[model samples]
Target: MYRERASRVVGGAVVWESVSDGVAPVRVLPDGCVDLLWSSRRGLLVAGPDRTAHLSVSGPGERWVGLRLPPGAAPAVLGVPADELRDRRAPLADLWGPSAAAPAERAAAGRPAAVLESLARDRLRAAGGADPLGARLTARLATGVPVAAAAAEVGLGARALHRRCRHLFGYGPKTLARILRMRRALDLARAGVPLAEAAARAGYADQAHLTRDVRDLAGLPPATLLLG
Candidate 1:
């Protein structure tokens, strides 16, 4: 079983899981987010933003917990450009050094999700945290605004916006906009909207545009995703 809820302490989602008697297939779709994960077997790790779907295997009887940080939060809290970790997963100890053991120890005490939240809180507090402008940019892009307008709203020129996005989101604004739009369409499709209608509502030029974008980012056609 998999469960998740919003975490007030960390301002993201806390996810927990219990795997039963089979190695379940997990499909991780790109959302431009990053995660701090802890497992009884894996200890502490970071999951970076993916540009396409990533499939992973989970063994039976395994337990995992994670705190998913929103798009801009990881760069500030982890003190690394999001580009460095793009499509990558790394041990927390390797990135943060021996001091990283502190969070692992907290997780070992039994509440891994809460420990992940505490880790985020402490890191954000110390780093003096996420750029509000980045969050605003994400919101604007999510609303189907053009990247130029979003950049202007955030007071950055086009090239400057690209640089900021590369640093904070591991991609330029155009790619971010594509991913966001893909997610919007996927959500609408999952909610039972017809593909063409969902594409229109999510700001695609047409159903074919939506289909191509979905395949590019999700590694599957809409019908396959919807069926599975």
Candidate 2:
């Protein structure tokens, strides 16, 4: 079973939990987000932004809880550049040290998801909150704005924009654009929109184009993911 909800402790973050029972590996699609996780088997961990889907398998009956930080919000709380942690999972102790990880893993309420959010909230405050640039960039691309136009609107030339985006989002804006476009298309399709119409609404060249992108980024076709 898996479920998620908006976080009370961290703005724009989602708290999710999943319990596995030896089913097939789960395909975790990329959505330009980072995660702070606690595994019943592994203790505290950090999941970095992904350029493509990640296949994850936990032991049977294992419980997993996580805080999914929206694009660009993780760096402030993690005290690490997003790019440095991209495409990988590391123990929280690796980033925050054993002592720091211990207290969070043993948070007061004994609820892993709540503890994760509280930890991120405290760390985010210490770091002065997430960069406002993240919201601006996400807003533009999510509406299907062209990357160059978005960059120009943000007052950054190509190189500067790329540099900042690499740090803030773990990838350049163009890649973020693609991820956002795929997400938009999938959401529409999941809502029962026709494939062709969803593609167009999401700025794809055609339904075929949307299929290719979904396969590439999510490791599945649109129909399969929608069914999933």
Tens digits of per-residue lDDT, candidate 2, 34-153, equal: 998888888888897999999998899988999999898888989999998899999888887866656554842378876787788888889988998987898899999999999999
Worst 10 residues of 1 by lDDT: 12-21
For candidate 1, lDDT tens digit of each residue in 1-228? 777788764454455555544556777889988888887778898887888888766667667787888887788778889998899888998889989987789898898877887778887889886877667888889989999888777888988999989888888899989999999998999999999999999999999999999898988998889887
Error of 1 at 182 (Å): 0.5
- Looking at candidate 2, the ten consecutive residues that score lowest on lDDT are 100-109
For candidate 2, give the lDDT: 0.89
For each candidate, what is the lDDT?
0.84, 0.89
Clash number for every model? 0, 0
Error of 2 at 107 (Å): 4.7
Cα TM-score of candidate 2: 0.95
Q: After superposing candidate 2, which stretches have Cα over 4 Å from the reference?
A: 107-109
